[model samples]
Target: MAQEQAGRVLRSVKWRADLTAGVLATWPADPRKRTSQEWEQVRTAIPGGEGLPSSVIKGRTRQAVTFLNANGRLPVDVFELEGAPRVPRMLLLAACDRQQATIERGDTDPGRVMLRLQLPTRVDPHAYGDWTWVACPISLPPMVPVSAVLHLPTLRVTGRQVRADVAYTHTVPKAKRTGHTVAVGVDWGLNTLLSAGALRLQADGRITALGAGGQFRAAGVLAKQHRLRRLSERLHAKADHYQRLTAGDQQHDLAGKHAVLSDEIQHVSARRANLNDALAWAAARWAVDQAIAAAATVIYVEDLGSMEAKGMGRSLNTRLSQQVRGKIVDRMRHLAAEVGVAVVTVPCTRPERGRVHFPVRRCEPTTSDRPHL
Candidate 1:
């Protein structure tokens, strides 16, 4: 019932936003710079604004303006949705309230949580006064800390289940910026995936390695990922050939084949996404474990944002381009935040011979207090 209600609200909000998009496209003023009063006036011009809550309308408009600013165009064909509801924080209450929705802990079982939603029975109603509140139990993962502060979560439906993407806040020790004594250095690899180890700075500004770190090897997963990539490429090529042969004719003989290929491509893409997500999390967990084992305060990784895959062989270049480097960095930062470890990206310089060099300060130690690299 909550999913249904939220979907309805989202559809209504999207419908209004679509109409507003069309109107804003013709205005001389920039929609991104519109004030709240200006947006309210524009909302009055929309036909179905009266049916939506003010907060929902405001959020959608602001979201649309942001999209326009980023893409330099208004969103069109916005009514097609996948049933994901982006409810505002105000509408989703953490405590018991006579509002749209409320989530609370179970009285009998502290581990169990409940979601209460107000649902309307009428076919189409402008107000929720005649709605009834219904309660349903929800499950939370065990990894959530007991002291974390809960906030309103976004909701989505998949198969026969509704999933809540809960966001929370937890206190962690602040990371140091410049006074780091111990740090981990991470190097990128293809089959080895990552090479990370700890380094310590001495009193005389000398750096030394601690121990040989472990490597994350996922040869099977990488093989599967490449296979899926090749299959998707073949499917896209065939689909393109079929499209050119049909030339926009829906009744062509190859139309069904093209449609099937498109569906297969989507399936393969979804699999790749899931695979990448798993690999990223696993790699991040391993890296954080290395840092914790070494008692390091920060992790230094080479910045690969400007690195290109060209000049390497064709297959190696493709693999490098498809590598989940960015995703791994993001996941590493998220996991490291929980333990108060800072993930810093240092600038890397590559020579003409395609050799990457990390900026490390090296000096001969006067005393044998720490191990030398």
Candidate 2:
């Protein structure tokens, strides 16, 4: 009896593997005719697929063909059973409506839902005896419109565990503006991270400061700069050492050492980049929050399209390049939109002949107007 039960388990595993392969192989030439006779021909061609239900074959074929049509290729590699390939957990489509699966409230606790799945009895008739039901406990979100269900594998140390993911859809309401029209002028600076002035434009061509002078300092900016400088010096020394070894005829494993040093430098550079991104995000969030608190309806920032890091010292140029000014602007814009605040970019144009008026007022005097630090 034990030997017979072991044989039944083996057959059930093979059945699932074959089913996955058969579904992938049946990618239709025309996805529009998914339920047509073409799928039946493809299913019969695949071994062990003849025993599968028509509903199962049709659902798998539709999904595979739709993916191929949308992407112009398969999303994943073609399924294969040879070489003991991993069989992904299968999703039994049209479960509740087709009576292949049933969900009910738990008798002991009404809040918990119990799921029962019907296994394929055609593969092995006596595998699960008369009642072929596999029970699973699940919890669902309140009032969520569940459209589809997905079967996923669970991390198990001993016994088997099955997980189900329910896909749902939700909608978000649009945002509407409130309060009076207020504007904030934002300026990106090298010394201070961001300088913002919250003000209101008067009808008599004047600006009134509501709440001005909010500046955010760049966190970890100097630390990242110091770390990068150290890494650069170390990399330079390693390169010189590698060059000296290569110049001589003496055999040395300088190539491996050079590669290792290069990898370390790259890792340090990546960490610096990650730190810069975090700092930029935090600074932008704080700036937007300050603007929102002042009831600013619009934010005006300089469009740095004509700006370049040229003519500056190498160290200063490198710092400016890594500053990611564009990313800061984008982050601020995204955050501002969430609160119904509009972000506008004005060109950084010079005052030409008879063109002295500007849209946004500068909080501080220009660098040419002030003495060097």
Error of 1 at 343 (Å): 0.9
TM-score for model 2? 0.46
Query: What are the per-residue Cα lDDT tens digits for candidate 1 across 239-346?
Result: 999999999799999889889989898888989999999999899889989999998878878777556676789999899888898889888888777787778777
lDDT of each: 0.70, 0.59
Writing each residue's lDDT as its tens digit, candidate 2 over 116-232 gives: 766655765665564466777777555332322223212123226544554322332222333334677777777687878787767775777875468887646755666686777
Among residues 3 or more apart in sequence or in different chains, the pairs in candidate 1 whose N, CA or C atoms overlap within 3 Å are none
TM-score, candidate 1, is 0.67
Each prediction's total of clashing residue pairs, residues at least 3 apart in sequence or on different chains, is 0, 0
Name the best candidate (by TM-score).
1
**Model 1 per-residue lDDT at 337:** 76
